[model samples]
Structure formats: structure tokens, C-alpha cells
Target: MSKTPSLARRTKSFQASPTAALDAAAKRLAAEGHTVCNLASGEPDMEPVAAIREAAAKAAMGGYSKYTQVSGTLSLRQAVSRALLRDQGLSYQPDQIVVSAGAKQALFNAFSCLLDPDDEAILPAPYWVSYPEQIKLAGGRPVIVPADAAGGYKLTPEALSQALSPKSRLLVLNSPNNPSGAVYTDSELSALVEVALDHGLTIVSDEVYQQVLYPPARHVSPASLSAAAFSATVLISGVSKTYAMTGWRIGYLASPDPDLIRAAAALQSQTSGNPTAVAQRAAEVAWDLPPEATRHQLAAFTARRRLVLDALAEVTGTELVPPNGAFYGFLSIAGCLRRWREEAADAFCERLLAEDKVAVVPGSAFGAPDAIRFSFAVADDVLKEALVRLTQALRR
Candidate 1:
């Protein structure tokens, strides 16, 4: 028999998403009759708001099954353009937007369009786990600059400047960042954008969690800083987080550069085509929904953040920086590692799952081996139980 063909070389460069893996493990345990508290995935447990659901059902019943423009429907793109102006104070024509399957695909499309062979994309840790992998898949190197827990895990402009090189082509800024939930202030983003401009690096600002902010912690888009910043930025966001519509899978990237947007659109066309038509219809309504539509989710996450921090305080050997936005808490388990004589965060997570039946992603997946990340998007009681179990695991 002929030998099986090897997978593509790019497959060797990155692993599957650790969050999805851990979530699957949690489900497996639950299926086995174990009481598992899944805090691994960042998906919000809330249902999509009434208007969005109504719009989707209306569209489906109306037979909105045909393909949309590869760049998304004109109406949906117009809605995205208006939303950008209203929320981030960024102006973009509908032609400048490319809606994709999700923010994940929009990011992939951007990287594919921006990176040539051996190009470098600067990423901060603990970043969303997919950033580095997506950059690598697009034939670019990920230049990681790690921020310490003392610094609130927010990357400094000095560190960003130091990471620059002749081959550096892109800088990714995820405000209300995942894993760490480090939301950069307006002034902070201005400094970082200045550094990127000085280096002539294009900025890919991921603002998916822009609406998930708590009071006293505002969300600022780097693209909104100035004309130069707007020109340098590819602003990415989606309805998934704010509208609790993760399964609907609608996201977009808006750029002032027509060439870049066109290239990304072409890449998207050859790959995923347009986002789902019914989902785009739903997302159109989602964009138009009042800010009050998601206020409850924000309120819930704020309370859950307090619970997580308080619980962590009681759990020995864990330190947190008090996330200001997003539904995640990235914890430094260095003390636990030392006390348990453990070296790998992944192993600790595995043991925690096997013993305490709580699931969380190891920070090793996000380029921070000394930490772990848990989502607070679960229901209040579920989150409370998870925190209690997490405390028990750490205390033992």
C-alpha cells in the first residue's frame, strides 16, 4: 500500500486552539456524569437579544438563503460603517468594510493580505491564543512582547518600540484584550499608535470586546486617535461579544486603505466567501440595537469579575491583575507552580480538571506559561461553583 501523504508544512507550526480542547474535555467529563464547571471558552452564555432573534427568524422565513457579496451585503456593510462612526468615531465607507465568518476570519484575511514570507507581526502576551497562530499561518513570525502582572499585563510603548525591526510589518492591538482583559486607555493607545507610525507599521486593532467594558474603564480604538492612526489601522470587531451571538458568526474589518481592504476581500472571497446571509441580517439589527441591549451582560460580567478576584484572593498561590474589561481573568500561577513543584501550566490545568472538575485554558497557550485563563461568561451560579472549585484545587 502507498504511504499516506503528509499534512501541509504549516500544520507543523501551530497547535489547535487550547481553549476549544479544554472545553471539549470539560464536556467529556460532564458526559461521564461528573459535575464539570466549564470556564474555558470565552463564549457568553446569554441568548441573543430579542430584536436580533426576531430579525433572524424573519430573514429565514423570507428565504434569505442566497449568497451575499463576498464583502458582505451592501446594507450590512453600511450598518457596520455607521456603527464604527457611532462607537469608535472612525469614518469608513461601506466599500472599506469586509464582513467575514467571524472576527477570526477577518483577522486571518488581514494577515493573509498584509504578510509576505518572513514578515513579522508584533503580538503582546498574554494575547488571544489565535493571534500568533494566525500570523504564522499567513507566513509571518510572531514577535511576542510580554507584559507582567504588575503592569496589569498591558504592553508598554517602550516594549513595542524595542520589538520593532526592519522586517516588522504589522502591530496587533487588542483593546479589552483576551486572556488578560487589559483594556488600554486612550492615552495609552495614542502612545502605542505613535510608535507604530514612527516605525511605519500597519496596526490591526481588534476591538471585539469594546462594548464589554465596566464603568471607569472605557474602550478606545487606536484608529480613532488621529488621521494618521486611522490610516494606519485595520479596525476589527464583531457582533458576537456585544450581542451574545457567537454562534451567528458575524464579524468585520474596516480599513481606510482601499488596496488592503480589496486584497482582504479577495482573500475572503476565495476562502469563506461572505458571512451567512441570515446571520448578516440578524447582525444588521444587532448593530442598530440600543447600547442598553447589552448593558445587562456588562453588568453581569462586572459582578462576576468581582467574584473571580475575591475568590482568587482566597485561593493560595494565585495572583490576578483585576481585569477591567472582557469576561476573562488571567491568573498568575507562579506561586502555585513553586509550591506544587510543577513547571508547566498545562499540567496544572490538566490536574485541576481531573481532580476539581473545573476547566480553564493554560496561559502557555497564550505565550505565558506561568498563568491560566478562565472565562466569567458562564451563569452566576455556575461561575460561583467554578470559583469555589478552583479555590479548592489551589488550596489542596
Candidate 2:
């Protein structure tokens, strides 16, 4: 008999992300007693809110161990709906919401529920590394529009208009974006909404980092701009980034369309079944908490952002665009490679890890070839140490 064949062709697009690879490498080096500073991971090192932890413990004791509705528990959905209304000024019914494993699964479910073989999804450059892979897994083509440092790594209305085609089914927008930390202003998002309206495109707004914005920067949800935009958009967000509940595995999607929510529910039922019951209960409490707790976490992240920006400034030849929000500094390291014979971004990162014991993600992973992403979600001293090592490595 012939040997068992491998999985389907789509698996090629699902390779482990460079950030994950770097994290694993850092872990291995640490296990071997090497002093490796990992700035490659996007996860914040902070703990979940106190109320969230207490709620989780209460739920575990209260026997919330059984399966909930495939979409989500009614209480969790209602909490999510109300949170969206309060925070984003977007209203939706409980039936129009679906809770999933995380924003990642919620996004995957959105694409799977909305896209087909011939559909196209437009993604802005310097996007989250998972966007294209998720699009491919849903059998949709990803049409990338490049964004440079000059534009704050954001997609303009003109760029969106040029990239949209008749076959375009969705436009994925991540405000306070992943690598660049570029936040979209209200006017900018309104212009993009007009483009989407004119072209009849569905907007998928990934606002997972909404609460982590810097003071001068604001996060504008496309769905909150207008009733039309709300009806045609799927707003994806979760507790992971906001409440520092990365291990909780709870995320939600809000849309005004019942059919889209139903489709996502059906897809999730056959795949993930349901988000954890205890997590759902815990998330409900998180959504119902006093605003002061969340404000404290935001304050901490804001301080960390400033600390990282200052540290990066000390390193010569590094050009930082001053990330307005999020805990990342997507820096241009092209000048650091001027003396290297092999000037590729990946080669630069590999050499830095080998010589300086610092792990950072190369920009090639995020569709920007001349930059690197430094996550400032770690403690201040660790961030400083990483920068020191990076400075030494580049100078060499």
C-alpha cells in the first residue's frame, strides 16, 4: 500500500509565524542558560485584571464547566453587545454576536463565513502577519496595498480605491495596527468607509487593541461611523489585548446582519464547538467591571510605550516613526545593515540573535522589508536591556 499522503495544499500558507519562531528560539536559548531578551512576541507581560481573575475563579467553583450555546452564552453575548455600544457607539443584538476562541479565531471565522473561492480581501501593508494566511485558508485572495513609513504605515483612501476590484468582498482594517502601532483618525476612517460604501465592500475592523492607545491617539471604529458602515461591517475584538486575558481564549464579533452571525456560528459549531464556558463567564464579568481598573492597565501600557520609544531613540541609525498607539515600535533598521555584506532584514535579525542574544521580529514577516518590530509589552528594564544588546549587535 502507498504511504499516507500529507494534508491539503492550504497547509503551506499556515506555517508558524516568524514571531512564534523567534519566541521558540528564545525559549530554547533561555533553557540552555543563555540570556535572551525576547521582544519578538506580541503578548503583553501584564496580568489580567483582578476582577477578571476573581470572576474566573468564581465561575470554576460555580460549575460553569459545561458547553454553552455554539455562538456563546446569552449573558456573555449581551455583555459583549453592551460593551460595543458603550465603547464604540455601535449597537447590535445578542443574536448578531458570536464568541470564539480569540480575535484570531473570530477573524478566521469571519473570513470563512464570508469569502468563497473567487473572493478577494484587501489588506493594508505592515498588516498583522496572520491576515494573508487567514485569507488564504478561507480560499480568498489577499490583495495587499503597500504602506510606507512616510504615511505612518497607514492605507489612504486613494490607495484603497486603487486596490479595490469588482471581486473584492472584504477590506480588513486594523486600527492601532499590529506592527506599526498606527492609529486611524476619525476623518481617515470615514474616508475609507466612503470608499467601502461606494465599492459595496464589507469592512472587517480589527480593533483588539482599542484600549491600549496613547493619549493623543484615538481609535475610531469604522462600524461606529455610520449606520450604513455598521450594517456592512464585522467588528472583531476581544479581551486578550484590552484586559490582558490572553490565556482566557475569549473573543467576540459584532455585526448587524443576522445571516453573517448565523454563518459564523454554524462554522464555529463544527470546528471549535464553543468558547470555554468558564472563560465566557469570566469575560462577562470583565465587560461589566468598573472603568477604573481598565484605565490603570492602559496607563501602564502608555508608560511602557514611552519607555520603549526613548530607548529606541538612544540607538543611532534607527528611525522610529513614533507609534501613536499600541505597544510596538516598527522601526526602520535599514541604516543598521549598511555595513553588512548580506543586507536582508532576516539576515540582520538572525545575526543579532546569534551575536547579541536579542530576539526581534524582522519586517519581512509583516510585508515590510526594511524594518523590524519591537514589542514594548515587557518590563522597562528588559526593554532597556534588549535595546542595549541590539545597539551592540548593530554596531558590530
Candidate 3:
């Protein structure tokens, strides 16, 4: 008999994301009556502000549950255009925006539109969990450029210079980065942009966490730097992080290259059409949420971030750079790795959950096996309890 419907060769080397896997394990334990503190998923635990929910409900009642323009509703696309100008000093016509199911899909569309087989995409180490898989799925090779936690896990111009090649099609950059929470300064971004331009590299900038930055840190769009830079960058973003609308899945890709934008739209149209109509309407309202509405949530995260830092500071062995944005601590467990004589971060995580009942993502999933990611998106008491459990596990 023929081998049971063999999978494609492209998926042969794929690794399932440990973040989702750990989260499921935590949930399973919780379902089995074991108390579990989950820091595996990156989703904000809060609900969208009332205005957004109300708008979604109203839109649903008004018969907005139909398919939209495949890209987005004209009004929603125009709203995204306006939001870009208002917040990032970036300008784009509505036709240049392709909205998709989530920022994940938007990113996939970008890579699919840009990469042919064997093309290279420069990805900074300790990146978002999904980037490498998405690049591989698009038939591109991910050339990981390592960054150190000591330097805040940031990619420098020198690193970019070393990573680029004639076949390099793009560089994927996420400011207010996931896992690392490293927000690239304007100067840093400017230097990298220079190197990227010199190498003829397209920049896919992920800015989903732009709104959640704390003081002394700011979010700057690389596309806003200059005409050349803007022309070379495709911006990916969504209301998921800022508006606590992960379920809404309202995300878009904006580019000055109409051809790339068109290709993304065509690809999105063939795959996942317009995002949910009700969600699109709610996301449009999210753009108009009261400043205080989001500010209150950011205030909470600020407090929780402090809690994470303080907790880790008291624990020996594990260390982390204080994140300026995003709600995760990319904590180094090198000390614990040595003390426990552990090799793979994945094994350490499995032992951690099975023994201590605390769930944190293995940093190996983010391209750094010597670290683990602890999210501060849950309740204050939950975070407090999780830290105690984490400290206990490392000691074991």
C-alpha cells in the first residue's frame, strides 16, 4: 500500500510552535482539576472596550455579517489610511492597504508576495514564534541573525550588513517586539534602513504593539523615515494587541508599492476573504476608542511589568532585560540550565509544567534556547503566584 498520503516536502522540517503546545498542556491540566498559571499564549487577557463591542453588536444587527470587499470595507480601509497618517506620520491610499483575518495572515501575504523559492529573508533572532514557519511556508529561507539579551535582543546595522545577500528579498522587523519586547529607537531603525536599502532589501515592519509602549520608549514606523524607506517598507498591524481584539482578527498590510499591495489582495482574496464584517466595523470603532480607554489598559500593563521585573530580580539564576513595551519578559534561564544540567529548553519547560504547574513558553521557540518567556498579561495575583511556582521549579 502507498504510504498513507505522505505530507509535502516543504513541511518536512517544520516545527510545531511550542507556545501553542504549552498553552494546550496548561489548559488540559486545568481541565483535569490541576491549578495552572498560563503564560504561554501571547494574547492579551482583557476584553475590548465597550465602544468596540457595542459597535460590533450594532453592525451585526444592521446586517453586516456578509462578505466585504475581500480586502476590507471601503470605509474600514479608509479608516486604516487615516489612522496611519494620524499616528505614524505615514500616508497611504486605501488601494494600498490589504486587510486580512489577522496580522499573521497579513504577514503571510507579504512574504508570499515577495519570496520565490530559495530567496532569503533576514529575521532577527528571538523573533515572534510564527515568523520562521511563515517564511518557510512561503518558500523562502529564513536567515537568522543572532542578537544578544545584553544588548536588549536588538538587531544592529552591523548585523544587518552581515546578513544581507544578492538573493535577500526582505527583512522582517517587529518593533515593540514579541518575547523580547525590544522597541527599536528611530536612530537604530534609521541605521538598519540604510543597510537594508544598500542591499536592496524590502522591510516588512510588524507594529501590532505600537500602542502599548511605556515611557522613555516610543514606537517609530520605519516607513515614516523617508520616501525611499517608505517605498521599501510594508507595514503590518492589527487591532488585536492594542484593542484586546485578538478574536476580531482585524489586520492589514500597507505598502507604497501598489504591485505588492495588489498581489497581497489577490492572494488574500483567494485564501481568506475580507475579515469578519462585524469585526471590521468594531475595529473601525477601535481606532476611535477614547484615549483614556487604552491608556487605562496600558497603565495596568505598566504595573504588571514592574511586578514581573521585581519578581525575577529576587530570583537568582534567571534574568531579563526590563521590557519597555509588550507584556512579556524574555527571561534568561542559563543559570537554571546549568544548575539543573538541562540541555533543551523544551525539556525544561515540559518538566516545569508537569512538576510546578506553571506554564511559560520555551525560548527555544523564539530562537533562543537559553531563555524562557513569561507573559504578564494575566491578573496581578496570578502573575504573583506563577512567579513563586517558577522560582520553585528552577530550584528543583
Candidate 4:
């Protein structure tokens, strides 16, 4: 038999996202009737807003199923621009917005459009699982800055200053971050923006969870903080988290720079070629709806956060940090290390799944070892059950 054709080097460089792996494992256990409680997935269990669904139905009935322009429909782009102006206090024209399948694709499009071979991108530790992989896929180097747990898993200006170099093309910032749920304050964001401007680095701010902050905690967008930051910032956001429209597949990128938006749109044309036309129409409504629905969700999430935190509090040696926003509790399980021969985060997660029937994504996947991420987007009873199981597993 002839040797198999060599696969592309790019294919070899890519690794499956850890969130996907943990979700798959949970599904397998549930299929085997283990009564598994999956705290692994990042998606919210709530349904999309009724207005969005109705709009989608109307769009489909009205023959809005055709492919849209590469950058998205003009109306949706206009809606996105208005949203930026209204919410973030940033201004952009329709041409400066490109709607993509999800915030993930929007980010990938930015990397593809901006990165060249050997270019460098900075990611804070405990970042979203996809950032480093995306940088590598774009033929760029990922320079990860480790954020100490002592700092409550937050990145600092000193760390950013040390990581910057001439080749630094972008710095990916996810506030109200996934996995960790650590939201940066206005001052923290401003400080980092100052560092980025000093180094001539483009800032890619992922604000997907901007509206999920708890009481006394406010989200501050880097682009909204200063004109210098806005000039170099590409703000990425979507209705997936805020409006509970994850399956709707509508997300957008807004930039003040027309050239960068155009470059991302060019790649979108050849790749996904705009998001679903109907989804885009529904998202237009989502962006325009009253704030009641989102505010309700945030309140419910905050209550759930309290429940989970209280339950986990009784367990000894488990260091759980209360998230300021986003629906995740990232626990420092380094104390649980003594229970296992191997102290690696992934190994601990595997044991918990096997022993407790509770599934969670390990923090090593986010470049932070000795921790695990517990998503609290499930129902209250489900979250309680998962926490109970986790408590039992950890105590043993």
C-alpha cells in the first residue's frame, strides 16, 4: 500500500478545544445512564428571546433564506453600528461592522485578516480555550502572560508591558471572561489600553458577556474608555450570551478602522460568506428589544451564583473565586492535589467525572493548572446537584 499523503502542517497544529472534549465526555456518561450533571458546556440552558424566534419565523416565511452579502445585510450592519453607539458609546458606520456566525468566527476572521507569519499575539492566562489555538492557526505566535491566582485571576499592566515586543500584532482581552468569569474594572482596562497603545498593539476586546455583570460590578469596554484605545481596538460582541441566542449563529465585530473591517469581510466572503440571513434579521430585533428580558436573565444568574457558592463553601480546601460576571465559577482545586498521584488539572477532572458523575472542564485548557471551571448556566436544582456531587468527590 502506498504511504498516505502527508497532511497539511496546519491540520497537525490544531488541537480539539477542551470545552468540546469535556462536553463529549459528559454526553457519553449520560448516554450510559449515569445521571450525569454536565457543568462543562458554556451555553446557557435558557431559550432565545421570543421576539427573536418570531422574527426568524417571519423572515423564513417571507423568503429571507438566500445568502447575504459577504459582510452581512446592510440593515443588520446598520443595527450593529447603532448598538455600538447606544451601548458602548462608540461610533462606527455600517461598513465598519461585519456580522459572522458567532463571536468565535468573528475572532477567527480578525486573526486571519490581521496576522502574518511570525507575528505575535498576547493572551492572558486562564483565557478562553480557543485564543491560543486560533493564533497558531493564523501562523502567529501566542505569547501567554500568566496571571497569578493571588490577583483573583486578573491580568495586570506590568504583565502586559513585559509581554509586548515589536512583533506583537494583537492582545486578546475577554472581560467577564469565560472559565474564570473575572471582569476587568474601568481602571484595569484603561491601564491595559495604555500599555497596548504604548506598544502599538491592536486590542481585540471580547465583550460577549458584557451584560451579565452582578450588582456593584460594571463592564467597561476598552474601546469606550479612551479614543486611543478605540482607534486601535476591534470590539467583538454578540447576542448569544446576552439574549440567549446561541444557536441563532449571529455575532459581530465593530471597528472604527474601515480598512480592518474590509479585510475581515473579504475573508468572510470566501469562508462562511456572512451568517444566516434569517439569523441576521432576528439579531436586528434582538439588538432593538427592551432591556427587560436580559435584565431578568442577569438577576437569575446572580441568584444561581449565590446558591452554588454557598453549597461549595462547606467543602474544605476548595478555593472558589466568586465571579463578578459571566455564569461560571472557576475554583482553585490545588488543595485537592494531595488526593491524587498526579497533580495536573485534567487528571483531577477525569477522576471527578468518573467518581461523582459531574462533568467540568479543567483549567489547564485555559492555560491555568490547578483549577477547574464550573458553569452555572444550568437550572438551580441541577446546579445544586452538581455542586453536591462535587463536594462529595472533593471531600473523599
Candidate 5:
């Protein structure tokens, strides 16, 4: 037999998403008649609003199902343009937008285009799991700067400044952050943007959770800081979170730098091509819907947040920095890990799932080995039961 060819060198940098892995394990157990309470999913449990669904149906029936422009349909791109202006007061023309399969792909395209081999991309700790992986796959090095509970799990300007090197070329920011739900205030972003600008860094701001915010907390786009900041940013967002349309697979990147937009679009064109045709049309309806349309979903998340908060409070030895925007609770389980005689969060999480039947993503997935992340975007009863089971398991 002939020898098998070796996999590409980049394959070494790939790791499957931890949340998806846990979800698969939970589903396998459930199929075997286990009573599993899964809180590992990051997507909303609700369906897209009626208006958005109606548009998809209309598109499918009206034969709007063909492939769109490589970038996106002009109509959808215009909707994205209007949305950016309306929400962030940052203006971007259609040519400056590249709609991709998801914000993940958009981020990947940005990294692929911006990074040369061995370039450094700054990522704050407790970040979304995919950021570092994506950067590495792009032939860039990820420089992780740890942020603690004392800093509200957010990167500070001083830390960012210290992490910079001549090799530094990109900075990734996720507001209403995943796994942490830490939203940066405008002043905070401005201070960070100032640091990034001083170093001539290209800022990739992921704002997918922009509309999933709670009151007294607001989403601020770094690009909205000023013209200089706008020019330095590659803004990534999607209708997935706000519209309960994760499967729709629609996300986009917008930048005032035409060169960056063109490069990302070209990269996307050769990869996934345009996103689904009908999803683009439906996302137009989603993007155009007034803020009032999704208020009910946000209301549900708020109620669930309270439920998770109360439930977690009863779980001894766990600490949570209450989320202000996204529908996740990142719990520090160091105390619980020590009590359970487990040295890592992943090991504790595995036992929690196997023995207790509650699923969560280990904190190690997000560069924080002593913590774990659970989504509260599930049903009220499901969340309640899962928390109860978690508390009981921790006690033992």
C-alpha cells in the first residue's frame, strides 16, 4: 500500500469548538434515554420573528433562491449599510461591505487578509474560543493578554500597550463578549482604540451581540469613536443573534478601508461564495425590523438571566460576573474544582455531564481553565432544572 499523504501544517492549529463537542455528547446521551439538561448551546432557542420568516417564505416562493453576487445582493448590502448608520452612526458604502456565511468566516477573512506569517494579533483572555484558533490558522501568532474579574473580564489599555511588539498588526475586540458577556463602554473602547491607533493596528471588532443588550448597558462600536477609529476597524456582525437565525448563516464585515473589504470579499468569494440566497433576503427583513420587534426575545433573556443568577447564587463555591448583554453566565469554578479534586475545568465539566447530565463548555476552551460557560438562552424550566442539578452535583 502507498503511504498516506500528511495533512497540511495548518491542521495542527485546528480544534473543534468545545461547545459543539459538548452538545454532541449531550445529544448522544439523550438519545440513549438519559435525562440531559443541555446549557452549552450559544444560539437562541426561539425562532426568527414572524416578519423575517415571512420574507424567507416569500423569497422561496418568488424564486429568489438563486446565488447572489459574491459579496451579497445589492439590496441586502444596502440594508447592512443602513443598519450600520442607524445603529452605530458609522457610515459604510456598499463596496466596503462583504457578507459572509457567518461572523466567524468574516473574522477569518479579516485575519487571512491582514496577517502575514508570524504577525501578532492581540486577544484579550476569556475571549470567544474561535478567535485564537482562527488567527493561528491564518499564519499569525495570537498574543493573549489575560484580564481578570477585577477588570470586569475586559482588556485594559495598559495591558494592551504592554502586549504590543513590532510584530503586532491586529487587535480583536468582541463587545458583549461571548463566554464572558463583557460589553465595553464607549470611553473604554476609545481609550483602547487610541492605543491601537498609536501602534497602527488593524482593529477587528466583533459586534454580533449588539442588540442582545440589557438596560443601563449599551453597545458601542469602536468604529463610531471617530473617523480615525472608523478607518482602522473591520466591523463584523450578523443577524444570527438578534434575529434567532443562527442556521440562516448570514453575517457581514464592513470597513472604511476599501482595500480590506475587497480582499476579504475576494477571499470569501473563493471559499463559501455568497451566503444562502433566501437567507440574505430574509436577513434584509431582519435588519430592517424596528427595535420593538425583538423586545420580547430580549425580555425572555432578561427573565432567564435572573433565573440563572438566582440559581447560580445557590450553587456553593461558584462565582459569576453577572452578564450585562449576551445570554451567557461565565462561572469561576476553581473552588468547586478543588473540592472535587479536579485540576482542570474540562475534567470537572465532563464529570458534570456524565454523572449529573448537565452540559456546559469548560473555561479552558476560552483560555480560562478554572471557569466554565453556560448559556441561559434555554427555556425557563430547563434552565431551572439544570441549575438545580448543577448545584446538587457541586455539593457532592
Candidate 6:
């Protein structure tokens, strides 16, 4: 081969999102006329609320299709501020918010702005797969603090303290957690926040799954616990999960520190200048339509969660961390994978899909290789079939 210029040094160690990769592979198989039951998707099978869609359509037709402000429209930012206060009591101003293409982008911007080349960020595992990858992409090292079924996959104060080093600059908290569905309690969060403050670390609170939480599992914002935490934490959220508006691509980040918010906005301005104008309008509408408003979708998701719980109960040699919230069931394959324990998790995921045509994400992708994460975000019939297929395949 002729001598060629190289790809960016920044991408030397980057990993593509396994969640997206699995979702896409399932979609490809389905498109190829295969009878695959796709439980790999993290999105609910629902449409954006009618009001949200209508608002976006009206805005687009009213010549509001032009590029928006770099941070996002002031209207959307203000709406976000109001919603945060109304929902979480996270007292943030419109100017302190920066809307991005998605919550993923907001996370990327925050990490990029905060991390130095060799700084360390604490990632409580089995975190969302993107957390570590995003940390790596920001030129920061991800120091994963692994949690297991015993702790419900949540980080304890001791774990947080042990993971800290002088180079630790940030901690990423995702709850109601993806894969694990662990919602951190206010007391738990307060302890973690205290540890973070002592370590002089910033907390990136990803609250995207907050709305999907089921009964008895409360959502607590760390930033709301104390004035210090409020100052130390950056909030990330979007309208995707709550309103089923994933394609809308409207997300925002908020922080009381103007300088940090400004820094992230500066980075976002050069990248995706703004989230879509129509999407921003739609997000504004979505912010007002609480998750309770979608009674049908909520009921369906609750039923799906219960269905998975019941199915897993019959599957011995497996343990599911009682999911307090979110639409995923993170089942430990440790007791079950008697033979596969000697092999890689990816192998089983592939073999299961190839043989049984049931798609689920390998747990290794989430920094927990002894299990798998299944999104219960599908129709009732589809979910039942998928669970049946999973049980049948695992029995082998």
C-alpha cells in the first residue's frame, strides 16, 4: 500500500457504541426477512405525543426552519429551566442551559470540556456502554468502579472513595440506570455527592431515564441535595425517553457555573451548532406533557417490566437485579452460563441470535461481562415472544 495520511490520533482507542451496533444488527436481520425478536433497542415503541408533533409541524411550516442559536433557542432553554424546577427543583437559569443534538452530545460536550488529557473519571458499572467510550473520546481515562447484583449495581460511598485518585476530575452518574435500572436514593446520592466534593470531582448527572421509573423507586437529583452539589453537578437530560421523541434529537445540559456551561456551549457551537429548530419547539411541548400523561404507554411499559420479571423467575441459575425503574432487565448469566463462562460473552450473544433469532445485548459491553441487558421496550406480544425465545435458548 502507498504511504497514506493517518486517522485522527484521538480515535486510536475509540469503541463504537455496542448498544447501537446490536440494535442495528437486529434491524438489518429483520430487514433481511429474518424472524428476529429485537430486544436490543433502548427506545420505547411509541410515538411522540400528538401535541409535540403538532407543535413541531406548525413551527416548521411557519418558516421556523432556519438554523437556531448555537446553544439553542432561548424559548426551549427557558422551557427546560422551568421543567427542571417543576420536576426536580434543580434551579437552573435559561442561560445556564445549552441544548444539543441529543443527550449523548450533551454528555460528550461536558466530558470534553471538563477532562484534561490524562484526567480520570469514575464510571460506576454496569453503566450505560456509552459512558466509558465517551470518556475515552474526551481524552480522559475511565476508571470503572464495578458494582454487582448485591448492591443492585449502585455505587456505595466506600466504592466511590476507593476509586478516587489525585487525577480524578469527574464522576458520571446514570440513574434510573440503563441495563441495571438502579435508581439512587437521596441518601445514597448525598453520600456519593459528599465523596465527590471531598475529591474535588464534578458529577455528570445523566437523568434521561428519570421519567420511566416505576412505583416505589423515587428519582433523586444529587444536585438538589446540597448547595455544594448543585454547584458541582452538571445535569444532562432530553425529551427522548419520556416523550418517545428519540428522532427529534433535542437534549440539553445545565449547570449553575456559567463558565462551565459556557465552555460546553463553545464546544457545541463548533460541532452541531444547534439542535433542530422544529425539534426544539417539539421538546418545549414535550417538557409540559409529563410522563403520566401517556397513560397507555406507561401501562404498556409497566406490563412489559412485570412480564420479564415473571418470565425470569422461572429461569433458575439466573439472577435479575430488581429493576426499580427504566425499561431494561439486566439479568446475571453467572449462575446460568455454566459452559459459556469459559468463553467470551459476545460468542453467546451471537450464537443465541444465530440459532434462536432472539437479539439481546452482551453484558460485557456495559463493563459487566457476566450478564446481558434486554430492553423491554416493545409490544406485549413481541416482548412475550422474545422472553420465551430467551428462556428456550438459555435452557440449552
C-alpha lDDT score of every prediction, in listed order: 0.91, 0.87, 0.89, 0.87, 0.91, 0.88
* TM-scores, each model vs. reference: 0.98, 0.96, 0.97, 0.96, 0.97, 0.97
lDDT of 6 by residue, 268-338 (tens): 87888888898889899888776567777778889889999999987876899878888999998876677
Tens digits of per-residue lDDT, candidate 3, 1-396, equal 677887998678787877888889899999999989998888888899888999999999998878889999988989898888888888899899989999999999999999999999999999998999999989999999989988899999998888888889999999999989999999999999999988889999999999989899999988988899999999999999899898889999999788998899899888888888999999998876656778878988999998888877866787789998888989888887888787757788888789888999888889999999988988788888998888777766
Regions of model 3 farther than 4 Å from truth: 1-6, 11-14
Error of 2 at 55 (Å): 1.3
Task: Give each prediction's root-mean-square deviation over alpha carbons.
Answer: 1.2, 1.7, 1.6, 1.6, 1.4, 1.6
lDDT of 4 by residue, 159-200 (tens): 988888889989999998887788888888889999898888
Model 4, CA-based lDDT: 0.87
Q: Model 2 compared with the native: what TM-score?
A: 0.96
N/CA/C clash count, model 3 = 0
Give me the overall lDDT of model 2: 0.87
On lDDT, the stronger of 1 and 6 is 1
Number of clashes found in candidate 4: 0
